[model samples]
Target: MGRSPCCDKVGLKKGPWTPEEDQKLLAYIEEHGHGSWRALPAKAGLERCGKSCRLRWTNYLRPDIKRGKFSMQEEQTIIQLHALLGNRWSAIATHLPKRTDNEIKNYWNTHLKKRLDKMGIDPVTHKPKNDAILSNEGHSKSASNLSHMAQWESARLEAEARLVRESKLRTSHSSSPSLQHSLIGTSASSSSSSAPVLPSSTRYLDHAWNNGSSTSTVATRMSDLESPTSTLSENNVPPIMTSVIEFVGSSERGMVKEEGEREWNKGFQESTTHLGEYKDGMENSMPFTSSLHELTVTMATTWGSSTTSAHAHGHVSEDGFTNLLLNSNSDHRSLSSEGGGDSNNNCHGNSSDGGNGTGNELYEDNKIYWNNILNLMNCSSPSDSPMF
Candidate 1:
């Protein structure tokens, strides 16, 4: 099939918009409305092509556009959404209420992209050079870990989808009495009562995970195990272990029991000093034991037994899990790998435990990671450069 021309070859202006053209277009749009762009230029007495007029109004002339510099928060949101959505500028723009896709695309290309490059990050992958260096430190070990994590994530997602479908099917069948009657009453009742309702939108996962919504409970549990630590050490010890210990010690009796005793003594002295008010208040006070018990239970569920921990971590098929983790490591390696001949050069630098130069490389890699995060956090202003 032949493609159509963007605009007619007749006498129509096609460069930057002039003030006169803007005024005529704006006045015409305000009074008569822009019902059709192709017909708009002639109706408004402008020489410009309809496309040019439309682009001018939508990008530059729109009253709702925020013309000033972008804020830090706005920049961060853009970076994060961009990471997830890639170069879908229009989609990203929709999330930023007062921004246009053209403006965002320009800013990312000129400003944010350059900044990330200077910081030693791949603007496209959002990763550092050392990732490849570390990956090459050990072939089999890193690959295995990468594969395991991937399979785990895949299995978890599959389980979640299955649960959702099952819930939906049960809900549909329950709502239809003839369908339910085809089955035994006991079976129908159990299915209807057990099936949970899912939210209307997939984006609702954010609120669901944070607030412990029914639909998100399984996913949230998995997330807690897989992502318990914000920062993993080079030694491979989970950060959540320390957090759990601190929480246990603090809530139960303070890390040092002496501190707890001292606080109790101080409270007693204060009560004696204000005897009249203290007696009334003290009568209604409950023991802190119950709160401590709840905390202990939560901690146990979060990190204690191996079986529950595995369940909470969610399942991953061996092959998919291996592929996921390997891909992450591959992403790192691909960025660091210089050429076909450089494989030996890359492998000789570090060890898997990072005991050699691997730790230093990982630390450097982490620095680049943080820098990208910071840049993303501060990337709000629209760039003056042309969009890709």
Candidate 2:
């Protein structure tokens, strides 16, 4: 004979548990502690099946259950657990005392996961989406120096992709001084409208580990057209690709506070007419500069889940970009004279798909394609950043 179902009888209740059912389950558990969930509902006089009773009790009826918004602490824990457990929500739920497996699963699908995407973090690989496309050549010893540089370039490409998507939508309307002001006005308004939406603060990532023992910062060397002395609501579509690389160390944080912070804040404050005025070489020469080495990034569109495919591979059809020639024949160099390497001076980034796509359509297509690059440098990026 076939094995009996857990709830073989018909008309067992399911779906959202009712308050009276919740009360019955709670009262029964309190009076005669539920030793076996499979037999609890019938003994407790509940119409719900064993499965539904177990779910209701574990997910909602429990006295200690914590509901409402998940705290950042809880979010971090869930992310770390999910990374280890994969889709084993029940196993993952063990660590979260008050949260049920279903609640955790829902949060992962609906909330925490989306935040990771917006920051260009791959929820699965726990790295940047661009890292997987790397070939053996991109990981060679000589070419490793360019890895972090490649990450920043990839992020810039993704950011530019956002601009491209937004600009196309903003077309047909002219960008005037007053109009630009108005665009900036309702930035925090709602999700329904497009342009004037501020770029995410993932522009720089500073990851501090073990109580400031070591710090890694990845700063995107924004192109002249992409800087804060600009406005994005303009009708013009900026170049699809540009590259600049910078590494910030912990020691330099004080320097930035004293010197660079002022200039950084000034650029955002001094918004001007960006009528294609940001010439290509405005930040010295293309592909490399005196202060920072430029890596010319070339991108290709992979099969993706984005809303727009018009320029999924970007306007540039070429596979390789010149002048990004990173012929690093030298061995690994250190920032300090001592044996210690400059953790801060290294480019900090990750490889993988973003986690925070949500209802937005450009979730998968937004990944940066580094035609041939691997993770040569370990940029321990801690948090996503915007210009702020």
Highest-scoring model, lDDT: 1
lDDT of 1 at 181: 27
**Best-matching candidate per TM-score:** 1
Q: For residues 1-388, could you state the per-residue lDDT of candidate 2 as single tens digits? A: 8878866678886677777878888777776666567888889998877877776766777655667766544565566445433565654453444566789999898876776576455676444444335323322321343333334333343343344334423631454433332322111221345322333332222221112111112112244224332233122222222212211111000001222434422431222111012222122111101001112111211111110221343322222121122211011111111232333323212211111112111111111111111111111112221110
lDDT of 1 by residue, 118-212 (tens): 64545664434333343332434333333333233233333333433355445555555333222211111223333322312222332332222
**How does residue 267 of candidate 2 score in lDDT?**
33
Provide the TM-score for each candidate, comma-separated.
Answer: 0.40, 0.36
lDDT values for all models? 0.39, 0.35
lDDT of 2: 0.35
lDDT of 1: 0.39
User: Which residue ranges in model 1 land beyond 4 Å of their true spot?
Assistant: 132-388
